[model samples]
Target: MWGDRGRGGYVVHPYRGYGSRREAFLMGRVFRQTALSDRIPRYGVLRDLADVLRRIIRWGLPEVSVEVSLGENVTTVTTDHDGYFDVHLLLEHPLPDDTSWHHAELHVVMPQAEPVHSFAEIYIPPPSADLLVISDIDDTVMYTGVANKLRMLHRLFVKQAHQRMAFPGVAALYQALHAGPSGNAKRPILYVSRGPWSIYEMLEEFFQLNRIPVGPILFLREWGISWRKPWPRRAEDHKYDVILHMLSMRDDLPCVLIGDSGQHDPEVYARIVHEFPERVRAVYIRRIERKPDRERAIDRLRDEIRHTGCDLMLAEDSLAMAEHAFEQRLISERGLEKVRRESSR
Candidate 1:
């Protein structure tokens, strides 16, 4: 989010959250914005670069008191050194099951400034959910060349949401997975990325522009930008942690993991399957890096994981992944047709 600017010169940023019937979570950063630069000017490449710089130029309001309320329950929490506030609330009553999303309000309490109020959207997956879909963003869904750091950084900062490209059939495939076999299953899709939290709004807009189903939670990394890691973050460990937390929270739900072989996705996913063999049904790794050795390694890893009761597919396109998902009963025939149509275009 660009954040809601208050007269007190402080901004309240509320992120999308997810929870179960027992507990709910919401996290955001409280920061100071000098001027009202919320809306980016639509121009050429230079204008998009300015927008990217604006997000990076942030001053966090540290140790600020933030109040979070879920239904009738309310709690107060303080921001961390980085101005990031993570609030966890225990619910006495279960949220409504008919709907997948619940609303929470966050109010910034400060003596020096006017009270700032922001709202966060929290999602509680229905008990009838068929599966959980977790996917990576970098090269799996978007066309960010992870191997080419210079080009990746250029596209990341110099391009706007409409200018960026989503992989062919990715939007259709993800929508089908979200709808599930009955077409209303509302399976929760959690996105994990190696990018920083600053780029959240851009990514959200990208999904909207591309018509991809937006998930409730997007797990982003905190690693600073560098040549080795452009939209840098901790290594594969960040993704592993996010996936582990999701699977642990939903013991009854089986998940399908999607990533690309451009980096260490195959290795991290293999490790997850070993740990939560029963909770993960399928792992789909896209062929981003077209090297004989890497492809062979993924193939070997796939064969090794077969006995763990989870199937790993190394596919070249989203359609191939959908076909395998259809065969596994993870997606419907109609969904496969949609993907087929999307891929052909």
Candidate 2:
């Protein structure tokens, strides 16, 4: 009697996820549609404001049971107080090698509410995958002005996906990395962001609109804030945990970590290198700020972590990063040329 379908309509927002042959994880939310509609309100200042507000001001259908199935695996999970469910799926056998993408079925089950079904596409990297790429979304890939709260908020609320810009040559560089050294490895690129889940759809549209290579997963954070704890927890802590968990899952694989010098990415990525030096092939920090103090700080960090065997590069542009990757044989010559061409245009 008390669901979105009862009053109007409810939706299961299943996020794109990634997995291995043995296990997979998918996260999603259940929300009741607003009085208007689920789609974003169109092109006016007031409409944009309403669009941003509607995303953040969510009414989560909490504590409801959900059924998640992938391949031969099937499980049930209950949404948290915020209506977010993390589906930890265990497969009975390895996923078939014929395909890389798997669509998982999500069924919502709650008392008095009609059972709603949704599909989540999960990417399982093929055996040909040589390396994994984990990247930051905000300042590293796009100009979100994440270092400044006011600018960040303004950009987030006021801009449409087309209005949101990607850093120059990013799409080309990412496509190169996706192609890998031999130019066809089709390596898995997993993006991890410090942003909230509310902005997921916007980010997806931004990637599509920018011609950026879409990652199989966009791991985002959940800020469970309250009046008593208004500040919430440290976001870097969440990032640290997420990276470590991804690293732990595939022991044989090596990954390249990409992030920006802004905020705590330098420190967080350095921590990852220090802990799992063997697992990390390289760490690239995009130079978003030109402050001397920040430059000195990153320089010092680079020197300190040199002994870990993975070099940290402070890239001036996407081309610089692509060049370094080419030299390392992490990307092919054609990939480097692509970035160069894109950067020029």
Candidate 3:
């Protein structure tokens, strides 16, 4: 029988005799648990590896899902294992006909978990015809737990949790970059991040919160136990591979490179400049530390960069870097103006 409980709570005890109260209670508990599992944390571990494996093979592992709805039509795509997804939106009525402001939504769903929807506004404008910005995200956009030596060692060796900090003004800068002129929209922004591959959600959340431009993403895979090799080129090689691939994808337009001085950005960017000196218009290196050794290294890198023939801007902040990018003609003048205004506010 249905029963009333205190404080507006209701208890269901159906009079049907197909099942005993104990069985009903057990079933209720199971149902509640299933619902609860959806709210699990991003870092939450599953109890059954078999279930996770099955879900991955069947429904496909949930990476990031971006859905764009324009009136009757909708487009949806989930990122791959590398946390990169490609979406090609086809319109029955091309741009002008379907010119109503479109709504873009992104949701990242973990297996048996609640979908984390973007907290920020997602807007999709007509394709291209605007300045393009390709940025690196790890230490460039978000703090990848690398600044702290102890934490870095722990994440790299012991328990891996690379999704720790958020870089200041990263989201603001991206929002500005994504924005276009009063009538036109910004070209697609490509995000390339390094390693671990597990922080896809964290990175996505940062983007959503900041309302960063969403387009193609490239993530390098973790080397696992093989990270101990003395070769510093291991990580840089993956990024270089990405750079080369991107160069091939785009015909001749120069890209804006945003990276940090923490790792091998100087080395990699220097190499890119040497190979395609004209294709890489400007490099923005985030200067986090100012130790004497780092200063010397930066000086050495500056000398090396001078040889490559690409302009370099070493800024302690993303806004500064964005400004430098705009001033150097790496991005549109409006892009830099918008970022500066937002950062000042």
Candidate 4:
């Protein structure tokens, strides 16, 4: 689920199910775009009620649906009786970076006299020679969930401020990537996420508080329960219009896709490789949870990697990937060495 906060809506975090599946829950925040009513509430103070409503629209709650994409295929799931739903993304052919983007749309239906409907798109741009690592802040690179399953579900919907912790070494790794000399280049290290748009200030505060590096942050504005949020505007109708739009802007650099194994990265990257065989250099997947038989799964995906000729890795830390990138001369020695030092510490 990926989204933002506004008067009328919010986007949810973009989710990916285990392997080739869409995440179980579609996350979004709902808010009234209209100004607060001047009338006082029957019980609570008018101002207090208005404030609460603002938070709800900004970061509290929103409704949505699940949409998953693998290669050219797409699957959609709706909320159940409990207003929850789950769908898996099937990866028959892993996409490569050159493939440009893997486009998927999720439909959200708000229960109303005239239902509100919305759509979401997952766009993965081709890698830049300088490399761009677009990632989600939640499960992809964090271990805030105490008991894994229980906490993960809670954080998935609630946006618990305290539970928002970074994965081991991720901060240091990102810092090294951005702080080192090579990182000062003109190309951008974009952070496009599905987290609340209103929370942008909060996220900036968190990044500074946590000493995380700065980058371009793009957030989706959450539409109503039924209203669909379309992908970034593009003139072309190529399924991967958004990503292509982003990639097309930068013609000089190849790209490297980084994400977790939880959701659409595998499928998205697979299609990217297929679409733009020349633009992507590698795909680095953080080995998060919800996986089945880790050893067997890695072995199988490894074979698939051999077939695709893409550098696929399951790393415990971004530093490990940085090390590989350094070895391949993808990153400058100073940057690689900095990551190594930070990771080792």
Candidate 5:
């Protein structure tokens, strides 16, 4: 099923990988573009509406073969029904130790058609790094009322990236975490969101505009809206699966998870702490909701995780989180001061 313009193409989404001298697991999606106008910027209300309609109408090519190459190693895999591919390869030689991201190439081959080539990048944190950061984008960093559907739609569709407002002091806090304790370690920062793949570019632009540290954006799934299914589907298991995959990637590095109390972060994070008792250094849940019941629930969860040696901070704001991070030795004194200065402004 080709698109409006009778043109068919493929897109290899940005992804992340973790490995050393032996093997690496690389995963990403190859979208079958029915329309070639996916890159057009949508500014006005009509344009944004058109963009959403176009994305909803687009289709994914299934059972297509794809080749991935990095350094001297190459592997072939077929796209699943949803056009997603995960390739695991044994490296001929270990990736360079000096950099965090390594360059790779992807080629999507179709029968009786020319192959499409795209550039891809994979991140590998340096060995000297002290900690890893897993963050949630929606209410945690950006000012999206995720708990309210109508308000979230207004903020997402009406406001452009530059016009969107980030929570105060969040960028500074994230920069501090990216620098680690010594202020030089380039720690990996992975962002996970329940948003669909259609808004991936918009979120990327949002991060760039807000100066938040960028990493692999692991979105849950694409919003598959059809006449047979009008309402968008939610994957409740997405966060647990993604976080577990990231933790398994690097067992040596303890991590700090940051999310907001507006959703299921506290419950999901509590489970992670219980399962990986030794691998979690801290979990920061920003207090976005003021409900007393939410506070009581989180307090009980804190008590449950107290014996695991994982510090759970239900912070009222970014400053509180930064202060606790400094006290726990997760971030440096200078980083804490930066957060304070930024929050004051």
Candidate 6:
């Protein structure tokens, strides 16, 4: 879900979902927004600040009814006190055997009011896919100093999507990974981020602006200060939980995990490798700092996962990663050449 709108005295916020052939899940929020909040622009520092403030002061519609349908399967659910609603539906039959995304519709079925309609998509990986690519967003794809709160906030509020700079060669590398060894296979790419759900639209715009392969964005919970709660809440084991969920959902597909050394990626990924050794093919961590301690720590993680036969590469640039991918037969020579050509620019 990218944006929210008010209709028939209700505010509806839709969120994206990912699934396989036989099952799918849909999520969204129902709330009421203030007039001032509704006026906030979609870009600029002022707009960013306003978004944070609005999320804190927003009014949630508790016990609201929601209807979700994909083909003949339909389900009704109620929003919690926080205005969050999640509906898991079992499809009557499998989705079509195609690489394209499937569509699902959601309705805010409130009593004595016109239904508010929103749409979301479900991505089904093709059978020809040999590997899945799961990546981190903040420091790995875009330049967000997640280790430094002040710089991160500055980058977030001051830069528009077009103004945000992606790391060199990262887009080409991801595109190659998306098109696997055959250069035509539509390998599924999933992005996991520590960012809140409020920035979903901004992130989507950033991906498009930078030519990154779009995928299901799994974001952590929203955190904001409210009258009832004066402080923001922190998520515990969020990355681990989300990654585990994704791995469990697509157990048959081997995955290549991509992240950076900025935060707890090494630890989380190391644990995943230990637990599901056979499911992981390789782990790529973009080097962010030149600190000896960080490198030593990542090396230790590497040693820990070495027994799983999943190679751990701490690369300084996307070109290095692309070369390694080609060597591992994950991407073709043409894809590697494309990545090299794009990175040289």
Each prediction's TM-score against the native?
0.93, 0.93, 0.57, 0.54, 0.90, 0.90
**Cα lDDT of model 1 by residue, 1-345, tens digit:** 443322226788877999887888888889876553446455655556665666776777888999988888889999887788888899886677778889998898787678888898999888889799999999999989979988987776667788889999999999999999899889999998877788888888898898888887788855555456554544758988888888888888889999999898999999998888788889999898689999898999888889988989899899999999999998899999999999999
TM-score of 3: 0.57
Candidate 6 per-residue C-alpha lDDT over 216-310 given as tens digits, one digit per residue, 9 for 90 to 100: 54554766546787545787587788778878888888999999998988888999999998999889999998889999999999998998899
The full ranking of all candidates by lDDT, starting with the best, is 1, 2, 6, 5, 3, 4
Comparing 1 and 3 by lDDT, which wins?
1
TM for candidate 1 is 0.93
TM-score for candidate 6, residues paired by index: 0.90
Clashing pairs in 6: 1-14, 1-15, 1-16
Native-referenced Cα lDDT, model 2: 0.83
lDDT score of residue 10 within candidate 3: 14
Query: Which 10-residue window of candidate 3 scores lowest in summed lDDT?
Result: 24-33
lDDT of 4 by residue, 107-200 (tens): 4445452333344333333243355545545455544343365665445444433336766566666655544346554233455444434444
Write down the worst ten-residue block by lDDT for model 6: 1-10
- Report the Cα lDDT for candidate 5: 0.79
Most accurate candidate by lDDT: 1
Residue-wise lDDT of candidate 2 within 68-162, one digit each (tens)? 88877889999889888888888886677888889889998767778889899888888878898999988889899987888987786567787
Clashing pairs in 1: none
Residue 102, candidate 3: C-alpha displacement in angstroms: 13
